[model samples]
Target: MNPLKRLASQTAVYGVSSVLGRFLNYLLVPFLTYTFAPAEYGVVAEFYAYMGFLAVLLAFGLETGYFRFRAGGEWRPETVYGTVFSFLVLVNALCFLAFLLWSQPLAALLRHAEHPEYIGWCAAILALDSIGALAFARLRAEERAGYFATIKLIEIGANVGLTIFFIYVARQAHEADPGSLLGRLWDPDIGIGYVFIANLAASALKLLLLTPQFVSGLGAFDTGLFKRLIRYSLPMVVIGMAGIVNEMLDRAALKYLLPHDDATNMAQLGIYSACYKLSILMSLFIQAFRYAGEPFFFSYAKRHDAGRTYAVVLNWFVLCCVFLFLLVTLYIDVFQYFVGADYRSGLDVVPVLLLANLLLGVYVNLSIWYKLTDRTLMGAGVSLIGSAITIGLLFWWVPVHGYMGAAWAHLVCYGTMVVLSYALGRRYYPVPYDVWRVLGHIAFGIGLYLASRWLVTEQGWHWLVAGTVCMAAFLVVVGWEAWRLRRGASAIPGV
Candidate 1:
């Protein structure tokens, strides 16, 4: 099979789990928003942002490291898996222990001193999630996308189901009859904490389902292989942590930087984070591609035409992203229903955040340079640059313009990172990436969206009609571009 097609097949399988699973999980946003006020939901948002940071730390970047060495076929797969998973088990255990021990102090620091269980529960959730990442990575390395997707969907399905039961079913039952058997599961004071409880249960169930892989990996541990993996993976930790800083720091910072009372600030944070769900489709696509793309990059790195393949892969990746961008932005009037009316206030950030995520996906493609070359230290350096910009902008912007500033901060950070990665990539490992054409795809996508907006607002065209017409035009443009690329022509050649 063509390599790109094979990768897409893998991505589609991963996407089935990631997109479908996260979409199912995302369905909770509206429910939660309606059930809890913005300030209440804000705590959920902040804790998840912290989870993003700790998750990268706990995984220790072994997912990519596992892929790199395993694809090289030098070491036994069992040995590689054992070395990575065993160490993760140790790391996550310690993390969960620390969170349990110092949950109060951490909760106090996070301004949630009243409910330290928030700290403990989120920590447990991240620990399980971090451990599951390597097991999932094992599936990818073995090309078990079907199994991977099945487990992911089952886990997410359980999470969504349990969440509803705890927050809705149990709550309603308790309200009707406090002495009912299921009523004990519903506690008014616990409120949004039930979401974390559901997540923790689901994560544990996922780990249980992967017990065969875990048990298989735990005993074959090799000291020498562990050293090799650590050496390669440590820099990945830095890169991953720094990447999380760029993607999530805004949420962590917004509450402090908003220059308002705690309640007002949290309300603002809740709205921003909830509206963030609108951009989840783009983020989910980037995530699914990462799950598939990283392995594909490493496995194909030694090919003579690898650069061309990377370029082609990126072109298609950006095309899909721009398509998603238009899909959401063009029909945002409809997509706004994904979040409750409370979150619709921050809807302006949706397009900005989507475009930022598109830029982030581009950076992900460019970042392959460092990973393939084993220059992850340099990759970390690039990410640190983005981290710095993100911090400075959050401090500088959020105090002034509020959540829109946070949105722009994401745009600027990713845009700079993309440029830096492309420059550094050309010097370290040049790829014939048609980045200009990729930008053209983005620019053209934006233009089509604008024209559609104009059609509805100025020309008085029906929105559905305008959206359909423009979407069809964008598809025709992409079709033309693909045909030209296939013909080895930048422009139409002689018939």
Candidate 2:
């Protein structure tokens, strides 16, 4: 079987969990938007933004380090897994202890002084999630896509189910009968905290389910292996933290920088965040591809033709992302309904965010050079540069243009990183990526989107029709290009 086909198959299996789970989780956006005001939703969004940062710190990049060394078959798998697991346990324990001591100050800093419990809940959730990261990475390394998908779906389903029950059903029950048991369990005043509680429950459950993997991987710690893994991963921690800043700091910055009251600022953030979910189609695809691609890339790295394989993967990845970009931006009139009417004011940022995420995906594809070559310090440098740009733009733009500034910041930051990574990769470990073809596909998608924006005046069935035609044309072009690539591949002796 072709390596790319195998990867596609694995991605599909992983997507069964990622795509479906995210789609289900996506339903919560509507539910939460309808149940809570924009300010309340903003709290949920901001808390998760902080989680994105803390998660990076807790995991410390050991997941990728494990994949790199484990795939090389130099050290025992148990030793590698145990080293990462034990180290994470110690880190999280220290973190939780600090959270306990500084929970009040942390809550005050985040403006959640009224409910410091939110800080504690977030701490627990991040700790559990960080520990679970290595366990899940182990599954990926072992090629247990089925098990991985099952565990992921279970966690997502539980979180979504619990959220709905607490926010919708239980709240209504409490409103109707304050003296009842359900009412006692449902705290009407704790609006957004319920979201955190639900996540905490789900993450704890996931860790419990992965106990077998965690236990089996436990062995006597190897200090030498631990030191080596940490050395490789230390740069990744910086990369991961900087990457999160690029992806999530916008929300965090919006909370602090916008010149408005707390409620107004949160409302603005809620709108931006809900609209951002419109681009999750592309985000979800990138995540599923990452799940399958990382291990696959490492495993394939030993082959003489590995560069060609990486180039082909990058091409197809960009092609799919461009298609998703066209699909979402063209029919955004329909997808806008995913968020409530209150959040639709920020819908214009969807396309920009989609393009930004597409570029970020390409950047991820390019990043394999640094990871495979063990020049992860270069990855860290690139991410730090992107993060610096992102922060500078956010400080400059969010105060002036609001969330639109954030949208532009995302595009500029990711685009810069893509160009820089490609340049550096070419110098250090060239992958022969067809940069022109990738750019052409992106240009074609953008042209179609612009044409649709110009031609489709009405927002009714006629607009949908025009968008459909545009999407169909985009698909046709993609199919033709894919066929051409396949024929070219067949002509090669061993692709």
Candidate 3:
């Protein structure tokens, strides 16, 4: 089979889990928005933001490290997996112990002093998720997409189911009969805490389901291999953490930087986060692509024509992202209904955030250079610079312009990183990406979006019709370009 075809197939399988699972999980956004006030949902958002940071810390970039060494044939796959697994187990054990000893202080620091259990639940979720990170990476490396999709679906389904039971059935039952068993089991005041609990249960269940990987993949612990993996992954940890800050700092920063009271601040955050979900289509595609693309890129690295392959992949990725950007932005009138009516105030940020995520996806594709060339430190440096810009902008903007400012900050930060990464990648490990065509796609997509916005001045069916035409036109152009490229490549001797 063609390498790109194999990659597309694997991405489809991964998408079954990532895209479908996230679509299923998207249900939680509406449920949470409707069930709780924006402030309550903000608590959920903020907690998860912190989880994003902790998760990167706990995994310590070992998944990527495992992929690099294992794929490069530097060590036995089992030995690498075992080393990563054992190291995470030790780190998580220590983290859990520390959480136990200082849960109160930690809770206080997170502004959840009244509900310290939230901190503990988050710690457990992070630890379990970290331990399972290597296991999931192993499945990807082995091309066990079926098992991966199955486990991911189970976890997402369970999480959605549990959330409904807690928020709708059990909570309503308790509300109806405060003296009943359901009332004893459900606490109305727990409010958004149920979100965390549902995640905890689902993560624990996922870890349980992945026990076979833990058992079979664990081999003799080699301290030398462990040290080597750590050395390689340490910079990745920095990159991952900084990357998280770029992705999530806005959500987390809103709580502190906004001048409003805590409740008001959380309400703004909830609105921002809900609108952020409007970009789910772009995010899901990027995620699915990453899951398949990472291993695909690593494996392709050994090929004589890997650079051309990567360039093609990057072209398609940008094209897809641009299409998604138009799809969502043009039909945002309908997608806005995905969140609650109250959260709709922040709908304007959706396009900015979508474009930001698009840039981020491009940056992820460009990152192939650093990972393939073992200049992981350059990736870290790029991310740290991005993180600094993100933090500085959030502190400067969130206080003044609110979530809209944060959205722009996100766009600017990722956009800058994409440019920097491309420049550095060209200098260090050139991939001959079709730069002009990629930029043309982006410019054309934005042009169509802007045209639709200007032409479809009124809402209702007029907007929908305009959007559909714009989307179809964009697709037709892309299809034509793809055909042209294929013909052009065929004419070339070795393309």
Q: Candidate 2's residue-wise lDDT over 229-319, tens digit each?
A: 9999999999999999999999977989898988899999999999999999999999999999999999988888888878888888989
lDDT of 1 by residue, 1-495 (tens): 667778889999999789999999999988899888899999989998999998888888899889988887888888888888888888889989999999999889888999999988898898888888888898888889999999999999999999999999999999999889888889999999999999999999999998887877577788888898898999999988988999899998799999999999999999999998899999999989998888889888887778887887788889999999999988998999888888889999999999999999999999998999989889999999999999999999999999999999999999999999999999999998887898899999999989998999999999999999999999999999887665542221211
Per-candidate clash tally: 0, 0, 0
How good is model 2 by TM-score?
Answer: 0.98
Q: Tell me each candidate's TM-score.
A: 0.96, 0.98, 0.97
Find the number of clashing residue pairs for candidate 2: 0
Between candidates 2 and 3, the TM-score winner: 2
Of 1 and 2, the candidate ahead on lDDT is 2
Best of the candidates, TM-score: 2
Which runs of model 3 end up more than 4 angstroms from their true locations?
A: 458-461, 488-495
Instruction: Report the Cα lDDT for candidate 3.
Output: 0.89
Those runs of model 2 whose alpha carbons end farther than 4 Å from true positions after fitting are: 458-461, 491-495
Sort all candidates by lDDT, best to worst.
Answer: 2, 1, 3
CA displacement after TM-score superposition, residue 231 of candidate 1 (Å): 2.0
